[model samples]
Target: MTYCVGVMLESGMIFASDSRTHAGVDNFASFCKLNLFERAGDRVIVLLSSGNLGGTQAVISILRQNGKRPDCPSLWNAESMFDVALLVSDAMRLVDRRDGQHLKKNNNGFHASFILGGQIRGEPPRLFRIYAEGNFIEAGDQTPYFQTGETKYGKPIIDWAITRSTTLNDATKCVLVSFESTMRSNLSVGMPIDLICYKLDSFAVTMRRRFDPDDAYFTTLGKEWSAGTREVFGRLPDLDW
Candidate 1:
């Protein structure tokens, strides 16, 4: 299992994903879950994947290799972010068609999910969550974030703090906090983490980084957040009347 999250805000979007993938206690490994596609001044797209690593990797490879195919609804050619999402979903379905039966015969289902976020030339930034069934839902004003895999542990912070008006920097910070929260609670998710930030109208990724276990900034932020949480908890009035 893994954890991937994306936030679509007024300023732009922020994305983060853990690198851990585990087949079993002894079979754990790290694999990048964040994928990016950029055409300077044209478009910038980020894909956060979770679930069957093989399936998701195959789908991403297909998109990257055939993005220029005239008849293929590739991310680079899609008219809108929504269209790009459809193309991704279609890719998921195609992969499922090819491998689902074999996996199921071995008692494993075709489990994969993705968080697709980015902007095209004329459209505003958008975020979407695509399931294994080849269907997706976009992030909206009321729901401006999406999470895939090991999501529950990190959702509360985003639910409480993320908004359409959130700044790119703040959104990035929030995602880091979310990632820290998830890493603390789940053994299957671990660093180093991949992060990307895109600013509206920029049509390019504004910031990208990989946070290793000893990254000073991340370590400091994690400690600060934990201290703050403890402080807040201490201040809450006791119910022991």
Candidate 2:
């Protein structure tokens, strides 16, 4: 399991994903769930995956391999963000065709989901949530972000804190907060989270970072947030039947 989040704002976008993947609660390993496709000034696309590890790895490998092919539809030749998404969707379906059946037979389905967010030359920045079925929907004003894997616990923070006008920094803060909330309640998601913020029209990632258990900022954030929550709770009146 994983918890990956993407936020789309007027200024740009923010993406983050946990590194932990597990077959069972006792079996935990750190594998980066975030993948980046960068082409300098041409485009900057970020992909965050959650679900069956084998299927996700296979899909990413195929995307990277096909993206280098000139004659085929690849990320390099994608004219717009929409085209980039289609390429990803197609790649996903190809992987599913090859592995989905086998995985199903083994008692696990082709459980893979991705959050695609970034910008390309000649277009405004965009963000999308690509499904395991090779179809996707873009983030719009009404829904300026998307989340995958263990999403429920952290969703409320984004729903309450994010908006189209939110600054890149503020949105990043919100995402960190969301990640903390989810990790507190779920053991499936864990440390060394990857984070990136891309500025609109930059065609390059503006900021990229990672946070682990010992990371100063994350440690401080967790303490402060927990203390704050406690204080707030203490201030509330007790329920009277």
lDDT tens digits, residues 99-177, model 2?
8888889887787888998888888888889888878999889999999989999999888879999898878888998
Reference-based TM-score, model 1? 0.95
TM-scores of all candidate predictions against the true structure: 0.95, 0.93
Number of the top candidate by lDDT?
1
Best by TM-score: 1
- Model 2's lDDT to the true fold? 0.88
| Positional deviation of residue 168's Cα in model 2 after best superposition, in angstroms | 1.2
- Compared with the true structure, all predictions reach lDDT values of 0.89, 0.88
Residue-pair clash count for candidate 1: 0
Model 2 misplaced regions, further than 4 Å: 227-241
Please report how far candidate 2 places residue 54 from its true position, in Å.
Answer: 0.8
Report the C-alpha lDDT of model 1 over 82-183, residue by residue, as the tens digit.
988888888888899999999999999788899999999988888999988888888889899889888898999998878889788877888999989899
